[model samples]
Structures are given as structure tokens and as C-alpha cells.
Target: MKSLAELAEIRERMKSKVVLREGGNEIRVVVGMATCGIAAGARPVLNAFVEGVNRESLTDKVTVTQTGCIGICQYEPVVEVFQAGKEKVTYVEMTAEKAEKVLQEHIKGGRVVEEYTITHAKKA
Candidate 1:
């Protein structure tokens, strides 16, 4: 409780980093962060989405959040993309590098990378 001016200054600094989810054209990026997801490395994927959105100035449109188990253990590190009036895209077995591609291509360019998606069959 120093002064009102200091509090106001802090608020101003934080304003740029805040992304509201009330309304507007919001694209929801939900990362699975349950135990399996963590063991399979969801932290980096989550970080990638957050940092990528901030870097590309897409924070307003994209809302990155974490969720519990998506119930598909084999796809532990799953990422689900939800946009209005569009089918949700589920990305499985994600890595930090793959997360970057999703951020750059799917989130930015609007084209989902089929290879990284749930439908893609991994080679033996």
C-alpha cells in the first residue's frame, strides 16, 4: 500500500499481457496437462503455445489454457484446437518443435498439419 500511482503503473504494464476470453473471435488452444500428459511432455508444448502467441502478436485471438486428462493415454501430450464454427482438431504425441509448427501453420495460416494430427499414423 504505497501509493495509488504505483498500483496504476503496475496495471498499465500488465495490460498488454492480458487476453480476455469473454467474447470476440477467440481460438481456444487447450493442452492436456494431466499426469500422463506431463510425463509425455506437455509442459514444453504449453510453453511453446504461450510464447509463440505472444511473439506473433496473436494473443488477442488465441487463448492458451491447460486441461486435465483428455482420456487418451496413448495420446498423452494431446493438444486440442477449438475455433468457432469449426471442428476441433486434436494433435497427438506432440513435441516442442511440433508445437511451433502448429502455432505457425495451423494457428497462423489456418491450415492444419495433417502429419502431426491424431489421424496421422506413425511409422513403425
Candidate 2:
């Protein structure tokens, strides 16, 4: 059981994350979290993005969220990045490590990690 002060600290931290999600002008990082995705390990992928975004102080520029089936069970654990002026990029078969790379290269550096993308998956 946490003391009131501890609980308040937890709430403050969570409020910051919630605020990040409420932004209207930030790049969106959507992770597929449907049953298939979870079975394939999407949870850690989602966490990686959220943590990385916060750690990098990119909360003002990025929003990480989850969604249901992306219509491709084989591509469970898919992540889609949407920026205002850029075409959406769909990354397939993602892991936590891959999420970090995507956050750095795609979200932060404006360069997609092509090897993790759907096109790359199809080619492999």
C-alpha cells in the first residue's frame, strides 16, 4: 500500500502521459494490441514506444497508443506511424528492440526503418 504522497506522485506521472496522448499536433504511434497481437507480444512493443518517447522528452512531438486488429493477423504486433505530412508507415513483426529503433530513426530522425516495414516483410 502506498502513502498519499506516493500515490500523488504516481498520479502526477500518469497525468503527464495522458497529456501526451491528448495532443492534436503530435506524430501518432499506433500499436496493434488485439488478441493476436498480444499473443505475438505487442505489449512490450507498446511499452517500449511509450517509455522511449517519454525518455527522449518527445511527449510534445509524439503520441503512443494502441488499437485493435490491423486486419493482418500474420502481421500481429504491427505498428503504424502517422505524421502530419508523411505517408503512414506500417511496421510488421515488431519487438521491443525494433520499437526503440523505430522511435529513434522514424519518429525522431524523420527516416523510416525500412527493414522493419511491411514492404520489407513481404520481400523477405
Top lDDT: which candidate number?
Answer: 2
Task: Report every candidate's CA lDDT.
Answer: 0.89, 0.91
Error of 1 at 6 (Å): 8.7
Instruction: Put down candidate 1 lDDT per residue, 30-84, tens digits, no spaces.
Output: 9999999999999999999999998998877998999999789898799999998
Candidate 1: residue 79 Cα off by (Å): 0.2
Model 1: lDDT equals 0.89
lDDT score of residue 52 within candidate 2:
99
RMSD of each: 3.8, 2.9
- What's the true lDDT of residue 109 in model 2? 93
Off by over 4 Å in 2: 9-23
